[model samples]
Target: MDTTNSPSSTDTDDEPRWKIVGPGLLVAATGVGAADLIATLIAGSRYGYTLLWCAILGCIMKIVLVEGAGRWTLATGHTIFEGWSSLGRWTHWYFGPYIVIWGFVYGSAAMAGTGLALAALLGGLSVAWWGILSALLGLTLVWFGHYGLFEKVITAMVALMFVSMVTAAAIAVPNVPDLLRGLVPTIPDGSVVYLLSVAGGVGGTITVAAYGYWLREKGWNTPRFMRVMRIDNRMAYVITGIFVSATLIVGAELFHAADIAVSTGDQGMVDVAEVLRDRYGDIYGTLFLVGFWAAAMSSLLGVWHGVSLMFADFATELRGLPGDHPDAQAGGRYFRAYLLWLTFPPITIIFWGEPVWLILAYGVLGAVFMPFMAVTLLWLLNTSRVPDRWRNRWWTNVALALIALAFAALAVTEIQKAVSGVL
Candidate 1:
């Protein structure tokens, strides 16, 4: 079973170590997809740097969550799904339907988002065609590439996103005074939606739970890899924090100063670009849009790979398969099945538009997943299933609890938004 411990770096090796940053980068990259960009840009346009604290808090929460997922894998040599299965049948029950519905809905949205970027880049192609092409590209890449290839591609994409976005922010030159005040952590009046959106949207989704799968893929399965995993996870989210913060800075400097109204959804970023063009000229706006595209595409690739992995795990587990049992890991039948599901099913939404009920179901399911993950990780890591020394620290527990409570509130507000539409 290849139980030999993987060799760690020697003390004398002073060279920059890229291997230390592994699946955590992939997780952070994938989790902080287009929706997160939209949320951050919106917050910047609406509240300027006032909600910058929420974005920072969101990054910290994700670090804790992803760290917990990675820690469980390294400590127990079990996948996150395996950890969840140990929680009992209810975990499966919730995850089973959620994966199915979430994949169907998210696939179309992700493809469309990717397509939007492609269409922007290539003016001739229709958005639908671009979306389909993007989906196929993701499917083909993951179908052929192993973990190392996937990680490399994602790392490059994250770098592209970071440079583009950070450069845009630099050109905008946000106010130091306002940015300083934003660090004070005060939510402005009547900003509940802004706060919840920032907190909830900071690079999170069902795919955050896939961190362990990626960890296993990275050959981090023993207690020895624990330190490396922590370093990897922390670095990934720190990058994510910077990307999000830079977006807030751009928002504060550009939109707040001009009193511009940012549109809703992913298009909000496009509007930000337009404002940048009007104010600073073409170069700044074009560069920001390029960065926006990079952010969206990185996320698309992440979802394409991560959620498919989760579904593949779920499918194999339901049939009583082992982790190394041929059909469970990446490139197995179950994995391809999900790739097909993610690529094909959501196309219907592109043509017909997402139904109100389906959107509602997706929102409801998504709102609870963070809490579900946090609570279950707490249970799994604390139990005898994991080594006592590797279990969560007191601060970890407190952070997880706060994450759960915060998501619970977000879930309630989401439900209210859903119900109000019906009434």
Candidate 2:
């Protein structure tokens, strides 16, 4: 029986909706790392509520993108890669190099991100060592395909992050009027990059592409669960918006109002934690650091698991395994290999800084990926690959086109930034 359209035993018809945290939440939370928070914080510190609207728009963009991914999975029992493969050889050409390169470089960045937080929180080890430890810990947790346990741990961590960051925002008492004005969407002087970052960075990156794999992991495999999935995606990104906005509020109060400047990158996050301590006392700073660590750790764990599933599936497909093959899912041979790829070799990048060529490759390839995903989704959802009834609506098409255009613009800036950083 094709249960795609039926609310069968596996569809959670008996479970209360409120208790079910869908796969969307996992993917959404995974994308909000230390870097994203600092981006929004710097924007707020520099321009007050000026970029708040960008945060909101970024969430909506992700919601649309993720929904398209999930819908493709349920409507067809095929994964995103399978759909990409159907599009033509070009997808294979693009995705093959992109995923391999993206994973190699991203693994390094993810570790450093988490390491910075831990070093800030504990103070016993250097960032590089803490980053290595973070990888080993992550590997141990997901080495054997403990999906249920992994999901639970992520949920707990997300809760920790939400409580701490939101509480800090509350302490800062965000200005009601300024926040309202931000919704009007006017550009301030020299705020283009900040505007684009906030608009494009929130709620996603390659992890957004992992949404379908996450759906399979959560057992929401068919169209009967699509309604629930949309609800979950919407709720998750909305909270993501608030979570990001709260950080901006904190930055506005702590740095902008006080006229203090913030440094760049993840270290900026550490620096702010100290400022948080100086202003709000030891306990508050400690709590905020925990939140920062949770954000970094959650992102690390997510890519480790979710992207591994994605890579494993791609590998399995290459060897002609069935779509439902065990090897294509978590704990498979390829899955473990990719997990190692995400864990071990990148430790060297932590010890030694990223090479300039690697940065440029990472930047250019990484920049193009967002547009690749958007344009591809627009293609897949509109084509005969999807059931006619399940195709993209006009609004969805318009939204994705705008998303593609927006990401393309950002891609130019990212490539230039990468190039200039090296030069």
Candidate 3:
């Protein structure tokens, strides 16, 4: 006798569209971080509204890239690592070294970045101490909390960031005409690198690659969730665009209009917060710092959970274990190991600066990853690997191809910048 319906059918029917937007929102908020904000601020200060179009393009490019990643996972029950494995042994060859080296460098940078924001907010502690504290706190939270709790914390932080940035932008009262004019694509003289950086780098990073694993965590393994996943991805990036644009607006109105120069890196954000305080008094500046800390913390928490899942899966595959092995799930041994790797070793960078060779390697590898991801997605999605209905449409192919080309150019530029800096 057939029951009302199978358990799977019942599960599908009960899942609402809105509930599934979690993974996308998590990825978008995590992707922005302090670096993306710094990039946007620099762009706004240098070119005003002239390069605004590039930021929007960046958002679209990320949507296409992330969508491709999510679609592959839902259409195939295999994890993304498994799909990469299907490509060849070369895939593992690239990812193995890349993750290890990149994680070592990035973990430190992320911690220092978060620490800088916290130190700015607190006003008395040294940046290094605050950064060390942040790393330990992030470790404790991720180590003990399950995915559901982690997701909730990230969502709350995202809300804090959005409110802070949007409110700051509103208070700045950007020139309506210039804001509208920025929508037109135009490049100022000697601004090509800034243009390319903004166009290709907005909210796009290794976190985009983490999308598939996040989907698995959210239980969107079946093909039925594909449409919902697409909707979620698109909406998240749209929100990302708004958040980014608000920062740009703040930069244009606050720094550009006053002919002020902010410093480089994450510290520039602190400088801007100080300027805001000096100009608008303590409350406005405090709000901006709060937003800055939220953004940094979101990135920290995200990489802690998301990349740990990725490393655990990689370790499982390397050991010839099944994908569903419990060790690959949250709080598993391998996951905790990577989470610790992301937390503790990086603290040493606070006392001793990053090595020259390490920075060069991080730059070269980081540059190539997006193009690698784009080209691979094009290969995986077009072949017999995915179901016919799930295959990328013609327009999707064009978007991804452009994304690959753009990223390749950006990668070359980044490598050049790294080499030049070393020289």
Summarize candidate 3's per-residue lDDT along 291-380 as a digit string, tens digits.
999999898889888988999999999898989999988889999999888888877777888788988988898899999999999999
TM match of model 3 to true structure: 0.95
Compared with the true structure, the alpha-carbon lDDT of candidate 3 equals 0.85
lDDT of 1 by residue, 1-423 (tens): 011222355521454456588788888888887777777777887788888888888888888888888778888888899888887989898999889888898888787777777676666888788888888888899888888888888888888889878887888887888898898888788889879988888777787888888877877777777767776777887898999899888777777777877777667777877777887888877777777777777777788788888888888888888888878888888888988988888899999887888878777887778889888977887788977777776777888899989988888887787767655
lDDT of 2 by residue, 335-371 (tens): 9999999898887777677888887888888889889
Candidate 2: global Cα-lDDT? Answer: 0.85
Off by over 4 Å in 3: 1-18
Best by TM-score: 2
**Steric collisions counted per model:** 0, 0, 0
> Local error of candidate 2 at 270, Å?
1.4
CA lDDT of each prediction against the hidden true structure: 0.81, 0.85, 0.85
Least lDDT summed over 10 consecutive residues: which range in candidate 1?
A: 1-10
